[model samples]
Target: MRVLHLSDTHLGVDRWFRGAPTEWSRADDHLAAMRRALAPAFAGEVDVVLHTGDVFDRSRPHPRVIAAALELFTEVARIVPLLLMPGNHDRHGLSWHFSALPAGLTVVDKPCALQLAGLRLAAVPFLRDPAVWAAAAAASCAEGVDLLLAHQCFDGSTVPGFVFRPGEQPDTLGVQHLPRGGPVVLNGHIHTPQELRLGDTRVIHVGSTERTSFIERAEPKGALVWHADGGHVHRVDTAPRPMVIVRGPGDLRTVEPEALVALGREARTLEMEAEVASRGGWVASWPKPSPQMPLFG
Candidate 1:
C-alpha cells in the first residue's frame, strides 16, 4: 500500500532565459533538478507514483524535454504504476508534443477513477471551478483507501500571495466528502509542500519538484511519500538550485552591462521592478491626461 506523490515537475520551462541568462545556463540546472526528482520514483521503494499535475511547464515542450520525461517515466513504470494529470500550465487538447509521453503513465485528461492492485486513484484534471472537483469526488467515492490527486492552490492565510480563490476548497476534498473516511489526498500547483488534516482525511501537497518560477526561489522544493494504508507521511527536501533576481527603476540607461552580467552570473531567473522617480517617487505614468500629470496637457 505504499504510494509516492510527486507533482509540478514543470519540465521544458523556457521562461527563465526570456528575462535573464543570455546564454541560458539555468536551463541546464532545471533539467538537473528534474532528473533528481525522478531518481527515487524508479528506485523501487514505493508501490505507486502519483503526479497530480503540471508535468511540463509548457504543453509544447522541446523534443529533449519530452524524451527525458518519457525515458524517466518508462523506467519508473517498470517498478510501479504512474498516474499523471494535466494542470493549467499544461492542458489537454492543445499540443501533440506531450502525446508522446510514455504509455506506462496514465494521463487523466478527464475526471475519472483508476483502481490498481494496491490503490484506488481518483484523478481530476485542471478545472478552476470547485464544483467540477466536488462532483468528481462524489462520484468516485468507493471502498478501499482511495488516493485523491489534484492540482490547485489551497486556502491558507499563513502563506501570503499564494492563497486559493473563492471556489477552491480544501475542506470539500477531505474525508467528509468521501463516502468512506480516511483517504490520502495529494495536491500540486502550490510551489511549497504542506501537510494537514481535514475531517480525518490526511491531505498533503508536494508542491513543485523544481523551482520553475522566480517567486518560488525562497520556498522549499520537495516531494511527499506516504503509504496508501495510512502508515506515516513525510516530506523529503530536495536541494534548492541557484536562482537570481534583478530589480531596478525604469532607467535602463543607468544600468551597467557589467552589473547585469554579474547579476545573472549565479542566478537563473530575474524579477525586475521598473519604477519612476520624480517629485514623488514610484509614480506610474498616466496614459491619459490627468490632474496628476498636468504637464501632459
Candidate 2:
C-alpha cells in the first residue's frame, strides 16, 4: 500500500503579529502548505492520504476556516480516500465536521480495523489516556492489523528542543504498548518529523505540513510516502512559509521579505511589527502574552 501521510495542518489558526482580526495571510501560508502536501493525492501518486490529526488549529474554528477546510478535503477526497484520525487539537471539531462530510473523506477516530488497498490497518485517533490507547491497539489485532494510524506521542518522540519518554510526559505511549513485529505505526502531535525502530515496530512521526511555530523553524516541513511492501518510507517536501528569528528590530533590515520574522524581545510595538509586515515580510510580535501564536494558520 502506498500512503501519503500528513498531519497537523492546523487550519484557521490566527497569529498575534498581524493584529486583532486575522488577515488570512497566515491562513494562506498553511493553505499553501496544504496544497503542496496534498499534491500527491491530487495527482494519483498515492492510494490513500492518511492525515493523522489536528486538522484545524482549534476545535471551534471560525465558520470560514471550517468552510475552507471542508472545501480542501472535499477536493482531495474526490481524487482518493482521505483517512483522518482526529488529534488532540481538533478531535471534537472533527466529530462535528465528519458528521456530514463527503463520502470520500473518512474519520477513523475510533479503535476500528479496516481493509484498504489490500492492507489491513487499524485506525486509532488521539486518546487522552495512555492505557486506553493501548487497549485500542490491542483490540485491533483481532483483525490482523498491519498498519496503525494514530495521533499520540510515543516514547522517544521529539519536539523542537524536548524529547518525550514514556514517563516523562503526560499521555506518552510506551513502546511496549504498540503492536509488535512489523506493524507500521504513524503518529502525530509532535511536530518534528522522525522515524525510530523500537524493537520490531517502526514508529514514524508524520510531522505537520507547515511550521506551527518558531520552535519548528529549523525543522524541514514535509509529508511521508510509506510503501508497505518493504516498510520503506520516503519524505516528500512541502513549501511552507519560512520562519526567521531576528535578535532585535534592527535585524529586520536584512531579513528576507517573504520570511515569517519573529521579532526579538526588544520591546517592539504591534504597529511597528505591522509596518514591517506591510512590506511582504511576515512580522510576528515575539514574546506575546499568549504563547499560542504561530504567526498564522
Candidate 3:
C-alpha cells in the first residue's frame, strides 16, 4: 500500500515575499503546492493519502481556503481513501467541513482505528497534555494497526536553530509513550521535513507541503510517498516559492531579491511582547523568575 503523507498545508496563509521576481499571494502558493503534490495520487500512483494535521492555518479558515480544501479532498478522495488527522492549529475540529466530506475521506478527529484499502490505520488528534496523549496513543495501538497517524512533536524534531529533545519541555513526545515496531508512525506539527526515532518506533515527520514561515525559508517543501510493503519513503518536491528573510545590519536597498539579499541594517525590533508574536515574528519575554531555560541546557 503506497501512501502520500503530507501536512501543515496552512492554507489561507497570505505572505508578502520581500524579494521576488514576480508578486504572488502565498495563499495561492500553499494551495498550488497541495494540488501539485497530490497529482501523482490522482494519477493512480498511491493507494491512500494521509494528512497528519494543520489542514488550515487557523481554527476558523476563511471561505477561499475552505473551498480549495473541498475541491482538493473531494477530488482526491474519489481516487483513494484520505485519512486526515487534525493538528493543534485546528483547535476545535472543522465539523462543518469534515461533516460534509464524502465517504472516502475519513477525518481522524478522535482516537479511532479503521481499515482502508487493506491497510489498518490508527489515529489520534492533537492533545495538549502529554500524559493524556500517551494514554490515547496506547489505546489506539492496543490493537495492531499497519499505519499510525498523529499530530505531535516527537523528541529531536527541529525548526530553524532549535531542536525538540528530551528535556523539561513537557510537550515533547517520549519514546516509551509510543508503540514500537509493527506500525509506521507519521506525524505533523513540526514544519521541518525529517525522520525521527522514538525508541524502536519509526516516526516520519510528514512536514509541511509549503514553507509556512520565514524561519522556514531554508527548508525544502514537499510530500512523502511511502511504500508500506517495502517500508521505503520517497520525497516528491512541490516546487515551493522562494522566501527571503531580510536580516543583519546592512544596506537593504542594494540586496538582490533573486539570489541572496544582504542585510547590513537590521529591521527595527518591536518593544511590545504580543505584537511581534502575533505577527509570527520572534520575541523574547522573560518570566518573573527563570533561573531556568529548557531551550538550552
Candidate 4:
C-alpha cells in the first residue's frame, strides 16, 4: 500500500516581517504546495494521504483559512482517503470540533488503530503532558507492518539553532519509550525533516510544506511517499516570497533610501540590523527581527 506523508501544513499562519502581515500570501503558498504534494494521489498513484498533524496554524483557525482547508481537502478526499491528527498548535478539543468531518476524511484525535490497504496504522495525536503521551504510547502498540503516526517531538531530532525563552522548551518523546520491533514511525511537530533509527524501528519526520521562518531558509521543505518495502521522498519547492537581510551602521541617515527601495522590490520580506561602534572602536552588532516577525502558529 502506498501512502503520501505530509505534516506541519500550518494553514492560516499569518507571519509578519518588518511589520507587514503576509498571512494571506503565505496561506496561498501552502495551498499551492498541497496541490503539488497531492498530484500523485489525483492520478491514482497513492492509496491514502496521511497528514501527521498541525492542520491549522492556531487552535481556532480563521474563517478564511477554514474555508481554504475545506475546499482543498474536499477535492483530495474525492481522490483518496485522507487521515489527519491534531498537532500541539491545534490540539485543544480538536476532535470535538472536527468530529463531523466530510466523507473520506478521517480525524484520528485519540489513540486508535486503522486498517488501510493491508497496513495497520496506529494513530496518536499530540499529548501535551508526558504522562498522557506515555499512556497513549502504551495503548497504541500493535503488529504487522505497523505504522505509528504521531504529532510530537522525538528526542535526538535535529533542528535549526534558535534561542528559546524561559519555560518555552518544547515537550519531547523519548525514542526508548516508543514501541520497538520494526514499526515505521512518522512524526511531526519539528519543522525540519529527519530520518533516524530507534533500535529496530525506522523514524521519519516529514517536515513542513512551506518555510515558516527565516531560520528555516536553509532547511529542505517537502513530503514523503512510503510503502511496505519503503518508498521515495523529495523536497517540494513552494517558492515562498523572498526574504532579504541588510546590515548597516547605527545611523539610518547613512543608508541610501534608493538602495532600501531596490531591496524591498526584490523581496517582500526585509530585515535591518544596526551596528554601533563600541568603546574599543569596533562595531558591535546583532541581528533583529524584520519589522515584521513570523509569530509561532
Candidate 5:
C-alpha cells in the first residue's frame, strides 16, 4: 500500500510583511502547492492521502478559504481517499465548520482506529487538555496498527530559530508516551520535515506545504510518500514560493530601491532591514520600498 502523507497546509493564512505579496497571492500559492503535492494521487500513484492536521489557518476559517478548501478537496477526493485530522489551530470546533465534507474525505475528530486495505490506521486529533489528549492517544493505539497519525509536538524535535512565546505550552509528547513497537508514527505541528527513531518505532514529521514565515524559508516544503511493501519513504518537493531577507547599512533614504525590487521579483516575500548611524549608536529600521522608487546611496 502506498500513502501520501501531508500536513500543515494552514489555509486562509494572510501573512503581511514588507515587500511581501498580497494575501490573496499567498493563499493562491498554498492552494497551488497542495495541488502539486496531490499530483501523485491524481495519477493513481498513491492509494490514500493522509493529511495529518492544520487544514485551516484559524479555528473558524474565512468563507473564501472554506470555499477554496471544498473545491480542492472535492477534486482530490475523486482521485483518492483522504484522511484528515485537525491540529491545534483548527481543532476547537472543526467538526461543526466542516460538517459537509466531500464523499471520499474522512475527518478524524476523535481518537479512533480505522482499517483500510489490510492496514490499521490509528488517528489522534489535537486536544487542548494535555491529560485528556494523553488518554485519547493511548486509547487510539490498537493492536495490529500499521500507522499512527497525530497532531502534536514530540519531545526532542526542534525547528531551528523557533522560540516559544510566553504563556504557550510546548505540548511536548515523548516517544515513550506513545504506543510502542508497532506502527510507524507520522506527526504534524512542526513545520520542518524530519525522521527519528525511538525504541523500535520510526517517527516521521510531515512538514507544512506552504512557507508560513521567514523562519521556514530555508526548510524544504513538501510531503512524504510511503511504500508499505518496501517500508521506504521519500520526500517529494511541492515547490513552495521562496522568501528572501536582505540587510544593508544606511537609512531608508539611502537604500537602493532597485535592489529591493529585484529581490522581491525573485521571491514571494522580501524582508529588508537597514542600519542607520544615529546620534548615540546604530539603529535598525525596516522600510517598505516601492519597486518604482529612485535608487540612492
Candidate 6:
C-alpha cells in the first residue's frame, strides 16, 4: 500500500508581520503552494492519505480557507481515502465546528485502531486530557501492524519552537511507549519534515506543506510519500516561496531603505535579526503608534 503523508498545513496563516506584503496575498501564496504540493496525491498515486494534524493555523479558520479545504479535500477524496487526525492547533472536542468536514475523510476524533490495507492504524486525536490519551493509545494498539498517529510534544522538545503546542501530549507518556510491533508511525505537528527509526518501526514526521512562521524560515518544507509494501520514502517539496533568515546583529537603523527593499524582493518571504542601539528605538518600531514615529501612521 502506498500513502502520502502531509501535516501542519496551517492554512490562512500570515506570518509576515514586518509589513512588507498584504495579509491576503501572503495567505493566498501559502494556499497555492499547498495545492501544488498535493497535486500528486490528487493525481491518484496513493492508496491512503495520512494528515496527522493542524489543518488550520487556528481553531477558527477563515471562511475562505474553510471553503478551500472543503473543496480540496473533496477532490483528493475522489482519488484515495484520507485519514485525518486533529492536532494541537485543531478543534479536538466533538462539536458542531467540524460538521462540514469532507466525505471520504475519516476523522479520528478519539483514539482508535482500524485495519487499513493489512495495517492497523492507531490514531489519537488532539485530546483535552493527556492521561486519557495515553491510556487510549496503549489500549487500542495491541494487535496488527501499528501505524500510530498523533500530534504532541517530544520529551525534550519545546513548544512552538521545538514542538507544537497550545495543546500537546507529552511524548514520554504517549509515543515513547507505543508497542514496536513493526509498524510505520506517521506524525504531524512539527513544521519540518523528518524521518526516524524506532527499533524495527519507522517514524516519519511530514512537516508543514508551507512555512507557517518566521522562526521556521530555515527549515526545508515538504511532504512525505511512502511506499508501504517496499518501505521506501520520498520527499516532495511544496514550499512555494523562498524563506530568508538572518541571525546576529548589524544595525537596521543603519540599513538603507533601498537595501531593505532589495532584500524583500529577492525572496517571497524574509526574516531578519539585528541589534538596536536603544530600547526606545526598538519599542518605537513595534505595533504601537507614537507622535515621534515615522515608520507607522
Predictions in order: lDDT? 0.59, 0.78, 0.73, 0.65, 0.70, 0.60
Question: Residue 52: error of model 4 in Å?
Answer: 0.8
Summarize candidate 3's per-residue lDDT along 153-200 as a digit string, tens digits: 887888889887655577877786786454788888989888976667
For each candidate, what TM-score against the reference?
Answer: 0.71, 0.88, 0.81, 0.75, 0.79, 0.73
- Leading candidate by lDDT: 2
Residue 6 CA displacement from its true place in model 5, Å: 0.1
> Per-residue alpha-carbon lDDT of model 1 for 46-155, expressed as tens digits?
77788888888777666777776777777777778877788887875223555555656666677777786557777766676566666776566553436777776544
Top-down TM-score ranking: 2, 3, 5, 4, 6, 1
Query: What TM-score does candidate 1 get on C-alpha atoms?
Result: 0.71
- lDDT value for model 5: 0.70
Q: Can you write out model 4's per-residue Cα lDDT over 231-263, one digit (the tens) per residue?
A: 555544444443323333233333332111112
- Lowest lDDT 10-residue stretch of candidate 6: 276-285
Which of the two candidates, 2 or 6, achieves a greater lDDT against the reference?
A: 2
Q: Give the least accurate 10-residue stretch of model 5, judged by summed lDDT.
A: 276-285
Cα error of candidate 4 at position 257, Å: 18
* Cα lDDT tens digits for candidate 2, 17-59: 4433354457777777888988888889998888888988888
The best candidate by TM-score is: 2
**How displaced is residue 292 in candidate 1, in Å?**
39
Candidate with the larger TM-score of 1 and 6: 6
Q: Which segments of candidate 2 are over 4 A away from where they belong? A: 18-23, 249-254, 267-280, 286-297
Error of 6 at 66 (Å): 1.1
